[model samples]
Target: MSRRDFIYTLSATGAALSLGACSADGGSAIRFGYIADYNGASLLAIADKQGLWKKHDLTVEPKVFVNGPVQIQALGTGNLDYGYIGPGALWQPASGKATIVAINTLAYADRVIARPGINSMRDLKGKKVGVPEGTSGEMVLNLALQQAGMTMKDISKVAMDAPTIVSAFASGQIDGAGIWYPLIDTIKEKVPKMKEVASTEDMHDHIFPTVFVSAAKGKAERDRKVMKVLQEANDWRAAHPKESIALTAKLLKADEAKVAADAAHVKTMTTAELVAKTKDGTVDKWLDGMSDVFVRTGQLKKSPDPSTFYAGDLYTKAAAR
Candidate 1:
């Protein structure tokens, strides 16, 4: 498709979304950025519907962005204040363009699928394994190999994009494919016999948490009151999974069935849970885990410390209220 990673990984695909407004101010008005995707903006939609914004007397000018980079860019330029972001775009924060404020959803859709006989990650050893070289598929494949006590050197890595990898798999050119949903779904429809051998869920010690990000370079000052209200929304999302799905679809302006399918791959948690995780150091560990993946994959020269981008203290301050 466009310049992107695999779909259902939440960084994939586009939707017909053109909603929101803007008003400049502090106490009453806030310029919020969000993508037209469930994993990114679902909680905000749910919270808004529950009157959390009004409870806090907020007039949020909710802006829809295409992807993380675009949202980060807007934040950097002071065009927006806070928004949702995916794991792949954490580099934006690491570079001082935005700051990680809170956790959004934990997504576990990255997969490595293989022919029916390939029952485990080890089964793909010495086989032609195709993946989009720089996508989450590649990361999941690397993690899968490590879990299987193997590495890329042990397999034939056929480096290609999502579509090409799917083509190769469908044509039997590769014994397995490292990819995510929608694309993985496409491969399944074309090659129904293929089954999942490994997924992000298998990497038990690691996480793929989408986050709520705010200004790093932008001029807007942080507001503890606003953060408190957003946490209220998060609380609602954790308690109402099914209703949240319906509102998230409307926020994304996407097909409800597609949204439902994608929603299954995510874990929604309350603000108290997120605060507890941060206090217990799990949030820092998760950020560092993703950082390590980026470094190992050549996306970063070295891993940046979580304190450089993560604002766990800030999250705590808000949640305490």
Candidate 2:
């Protein structure tokens, strides 16, 4: 099935309700939210399938959402204890409603693809550019425009969800789009001429960190253990690369080679490394930059103090175990 079709199937079938059978030990259960994207949440799937959560005393019930905004809303309402989200989704709600506990991966996932004849970022001026408004797709586009000495006003902005943006791109409805995989990969397969003009790889410093977020109320002892075990799962993936790739590919129903290649682009950190980054101001610096982009995009009225949103103590404690 197509990426759009696959997402529709996930939504219509109530995929969240089928996150494996509930744990008989109700006290150990945790509601985990994640996007059904290959790049971001595949590790969570690997953990689930490999029984890592059980080892860590977490009976994780996976909740799948279509996009980051919806997942953030679930988190804000306390329906989810933990979720994976991009920096664009994290910054605004994280300022008050949620706390980011871990940076799961630094991924070169987002891409700016232009239709035929639009050769450069400058060529995108005066053309229609599609972006998923509230997610990292828009953030990356905004950053790219700023880097090109332009603004959103320089182009006609078309806001759509990632899948629809891919459809629009295929139909020649939008001149280009700022999107991530597997939509980008799907689009390229259908529209071979789609030119990739920019990506997160180009905006290295401005890139958004895909993170694990939780509401303040959910940060109990069990939730903290969940975070640590997630790091343990990441370490497991690194140590057992072949097995990791096989399981993730099977879960995502994607090709193992493609999954392996995509996985390579993501740098997963350990619990100790996470603590060090948090302490040395690296996380703060990245969030500060993202906050400025959020304000410029009108996603936030004012930038919140970037330091207030992190829960570094969780990782520090998790690492101790």
Candidate 3:
């Protein structure tokens, strides 16, 4: 895509999150890929503010994409050294375009926002629902629908980027949404009549897992070092939620209040917490959940064994040090 097409796509997602600027480094530094939303790359943004990259002596450049699929496509072109993607884009790794160097943050933070008079998930049948394709938003929507004894077939599904979803919901163009912050917060601020019909918080069996992806060929040890920095940042964010939100708002050029609203949906884990989760098979299970959604959504014909692309053993070894 050209610069104009790229900018337009990013804006349409409604995150308006930018990683500042990039350089013509010519392979001098790692071209780090991240989604252009706080939800997409919040961990890395926090690490950047915390000076973890410099502390680790790792050179990484932030390249912003509208969503995980775009990020994965860039990864395939030999541009991005590594990237973080939500469950919606997990198919990329399952197909061998990239490898999961580290199981990224795991969470259950999405909610269904509906126009008033729609009191519960059951009411969504035949109603227009907007969600970004392959997003945790969609994952949450699917689970929420299942809870109501329904599926995507029950609702009029409209695939949109987060920004477009926000616009449509705010202007009464759509009936509901399965989107995350800061877009969710935007709807709350602008559309007073909107009611939250469902939250992933109530779904114990569902998890929105994202992972750090490297090109199909990546340095195992080096990726672990990068994972170390991310885990440290994750731990730090867990300990300082308010500061993390403030820093994210400043970084995204977004409102502090809106970013703060996102805390309810974000769950940051410490290294010990991650170490524990990794050992218990929780990470593997979530990876399965991620890949399963793509197949159910008809994005992938077959999802490779989640373990086939997972490099979590390397993460456990890194944490041991």
Give the Cα-based TM-score of candidate 3 against the true structure: 0.83
TM-score of each: 0.72, 0.89, 0.83
Global lDDT of each model?
Answer: 0.73, 0.73, 0.73
Count of clashes in candidate 3? 3
Clashing pairs in 2: none
> Residue by residue across 6-47, what tens digits does model 1's lDDT show?
233232212222122422334435677775556767766766
Give the lDDT of residue 63 in candidate 3: 67
Between candidates 1 and 3, the TM-score winner? 3
Pairs of residues clashing in candidate 3:
13-163, 14-163, 88-134
Best candidate according to lDDT: 2
RMSD of candidate 2 to true structure, Å: 2.7
Ranking by TM-score: 2, 3, 1
